[model samples]
Target chain A: MACHELIEGHLQALARSLPASVVEELRDGLIESYEDQLERLGDAEAAAHAAIADFGDADTVTAAFVRASPGRGIAVRLLLAGPVVGLSWAAALIAGHWWTWPISPPLRLAVGLVLGLAVLMLIVAVRERHHYRTVRLAALAGATGVAVLDTTLLATVVMLPAGPSVLLVPALAASVARVLLVVRAVPEMISDP
Target chain B: MRAEALKGHLDGLLLAALEDGPRHGYAVKEALRDATDGKLDLPTGTVYPALHRLEQAGLISGSWVVVAGRRRRTYELTEDGRRSLKGARDNWQEFAAVVSTALRGAPWPATS
Candidate 1:
């Protein structure tokens, strides 16, 4: 039997926040329940409304799902890794240029500010409050920091007639890779409804 | 009753609903309603998360079962769940007695 519009919409909303396997089982249960209600009430439309009302709204249900889900493990790992990775890249950049051109205090200050904000957001993410918000902000800040630091390093490598050290080349490559990951993730994370 | 009133008691109610045998999410909801004489109404969506939480806590177990040509997830109580339910029932009884006595201003011991 086809699902009622309201029932389908509610299930879809839940699927947005819950794992697909959980949602698949939930969908079946909902359909079966709705069918029973339809038989009892002898009216499909009324049964759908009753089912939805009895079930509660999508927001309440999804909130509970998120709170119970183990899905935040990846987010936790990313946030926990953020500062360590950022600092490693910073150390490499400093080693490469701190003695020669000194990379300008203003640029250094900007990187520090972004990294600080990223760390703060990461703290919030770890605490599990406003989870997706904190994770998104931290990822965005981390990505911006990567962009700023990488651009400065690349420019230094190019304009410095001395060129960068072979040792620093690997660190710079690693920063590029991190930048790609953060950039790829930001869109997906921020676009989450 | 309201959802807020039922919130703390929901875990026990869910365990009790599954006490007889394994049941799907919707069936559990229906059992809760029927047991409460339709007084314990809540949004149906909320039960799924509660079930997941119980499963995570190791009080209940869930799996997919085919029913009426469709797949549904059914939940059953573990030994732990049964023990917890007994504890919950005892606690509710004591709590209700305290509230009822206080409300009626009745003495603990009857005097003629």
Candidate 2:
């Protein structure tokens, strides 16, 4: 069952754009279909041809699978929500007097890294439509990154030397909201297929 | 029939195909083709992605198994999927009836 010639070629074409699991499932199905065709036609080549025809061209088949993925939708949702959450935190920080805090260059660097990852995730999600795996990876990374950064922000607000002031409420609220959303979405972003 | 004609209904049609029992992707394609009398409009390859999408939606579930000494991934409708399929059927029936009325140059039946 693993060794298929004609159908393997088609799968190879699909593998260029699809995840391995998706390609693997297609391989199984196509081989089964080819065997079914062989049973009736009694000619290997003809059966292969018939099977391939029914599945259509590599381009169309790959496109269909790509379109079916949820990665892009999740990425776009994260992208849309990011700014709102960002603005909320900014408002809280500016109003709460961020200048008095003993923030280090290393902490600032870490924050910048997370923000960079977020931007990269958005770019990949918006620009790359051909390969779904890339988008899925970006979303997973984005969610995890946001969860880490947001959790840290919430912790700092609670344990700050300066009392957790009412002005910090919006930032804390936004971080909590994002953490909840990330908790809900991260499992979904896991590669089940 | 044209693929265009089958657009937007592929998910429901796929759900219907899996209604009877769990089926491998190839079997689903066969069932769809047979049910349509060999006139299934869309490409057979599409069944995989549609099945995957349904799985993501929690409508159907897929698992790997051996069949006749060959590996295959099979799909079965979940409880949510059964409800979805029923909803699909209801919608299709209503749409068909309404469109049929329009096509026949007759007015729709009065709503109760």
Candidate 3:
């Protein structure tokens, strides 16, 4: 079969198991893949077929498409986990009855904001430094930052002397934002040609 | 061969196929083969992945149905898919014109 025919046939086979929208996207991606491979191999059809064979069968490729679909990232996980962690820490502060730090409420809020933003910046910087070239590293950094922020906020609340219940709300809110930042960063991290 | 050259146009062809109506995977393959007079031949395996990718991009939707005592997946285009197909069709026309002109011993406009 000609390369185009083979690709069309493969695409039709894929349509069986997926929605048309997804099949279309994969079709575009596959075309790009084939074009790139063809260029590398001097536009030889035989070379393209060999490359496809090496890449594995259609089912494997379909599963890969499913796996790479946007939702399954550490950033998304952190985003989802953020509100729960925030509420948990707020509950802990309320129920645990810990002393407030020597700092006043306004100072604590300022500190939290600065720390949160700094952590957000660090996460962004680490991610940008790699330019989505190291997804695992980016995911690890994002998850770690969120985890540390969560832990620190919980610890600070436990250490602080009694303060207005209102103070915990802002801290919780800041943590939630931090989590969102991490989640949003995930797409940038995983996006690659 | 021109068919090999047209490999990049598979998405457009798929959208065109779905334009007629929804069809299952095997049927789509058979139709394309018939349309091309057997010029385009494909392994039985390549179509499924391409279909899934298209679905992911919101260009088409698909579902499974049992036909003739066997299960098969059916696919159809979405609004976005229709728009994309039109674009692909226009591009392919222009591209084919240029390539055919070049192949016929005519200088490209820029070169001429």
Candidate 4:
């Protein structure tokens, strides 16, 4: 069997679940396994069958890749939790009349950039267009961005005159929770396959 | 054996596969199958992800190579991988010994 013919169907089945690079690698792997089997089995048809069988089912393989890569999951999670975290901070900001506070320009710009990065991460993670590496990078960037943003925001909140007050409590708690979650996810983010 | 049966030890088995030398993904699968005499016939999906995980941990590294007119990814153990394998070997020996002793001393189960 031609190598491409041997694994084309498998790759197509895996197209949605895995990145292009991984799919390409898997294609090569399947073909190689088929060729090896052919040498032993001495029949092209049987070799193809054995090779695919040896690689296992598409869903099972997809799950394995998903387990190995935390990029998409992290991005989805951060994005999903975004509005709640933002709203909590917003409620506190409004309650405390934060607009009247002397917030630094660069700090605001930093927040904007981090928010933009979060948006980009969402698109990259949800799209099938990017490779696993890009997804991982976007996710890591998103996580790190959120963690820094939360920590910085928390620090600024603490410095305010109404620090730790009832009005600011929700914002403070949200930032702290986000920071903790990011800390726990750092290992998974870096565990690139 | 079932794929789940090899979960914790799969990494160790994969690391051992590379102990002899670098091999491509399929070759590694063949080596394991040969070593276990088909007992280790793994779920085809299970092996690659495990290899990736090992690579992430810095225990193994993969590179592309041309073989017989085709490009393939080959993997080899790193220094860390070697040390880890040594540790795994020692641990497995001790574990197997204890289990062997325990099982050896147990009375045979009566036929159901």
Instruction: Estimate, for each residue in A1-193, the C-alpha lDDT of model 2 and write its tens digit.
Output: 4445888888898889887877878887788778888889988889999889988888877666656667665667777888988888887888778778888879978988998897687668666757767777877787778888898887777677765567677777778887898788777667657
Which residue segments of model 3 deviate by more than 4 Å? A1-193, B1-4, B108-112
TM-score leaderboard ranking: 2, 4, 1, 3
Q: Backbone clashes per model, in order?
A: 5, 0, 38, 2
lDDT of 4 by residue, B1-112 (tens): 8777775788889999999999877778879999989988875567787788788678999988776666677899999999999998998999889889888878766898
> Once model 4 is optimally superposed onto the true structure by TM-score, how far is the C-alpha of residue A190 displaced, in angstroms?
11
Per-residue alpha-carbon lDDT of candidate 3 for residues B1-112, written as tens digits (9 for 90 to 100): 2436657887787778789999755456557777889876554345554665687677989876654343456889999999999999899899889889888997556763
Fraction of native contacts, model 3: 0.05
Q: Write the per-residue lDDT of candidate 3 for residues A1-193, one digit (tens) a residue.
A: 1346666777777676544655555554455446556777875575557545633566665554444433224445555565666676667565546443465688567657754764454445333321222334545554655646665665665676656576577666667666565566555444431
**lDDT by candidate, in order shown:** 0.71, 0.80, 0.60, 0.78
Chain A TM-scores, candidates in order: 0.55, 0.79, 0.37, 0.70
lDDT of 1 by residue, A81-116 (tens): 656666765676567665576468886687678666
Q: Which is the winner by lDDT between candidate 1 and candidate 3?
A: 1
Clashing pairs in 4: A54-B44, A55-B44
> Cα deviation of A70 in candidate 3 (Å)?
4.9
lDDT of 1 at B63: 78
Best by lDDT: 2
Each candidate's DockQ score against the native complex? 0.48, 0.67, 0.04, 0.41
Q: Model 2, stretches more than 4 Å misplaced?
A: A1-4, A161-171, A187-192, B106-112
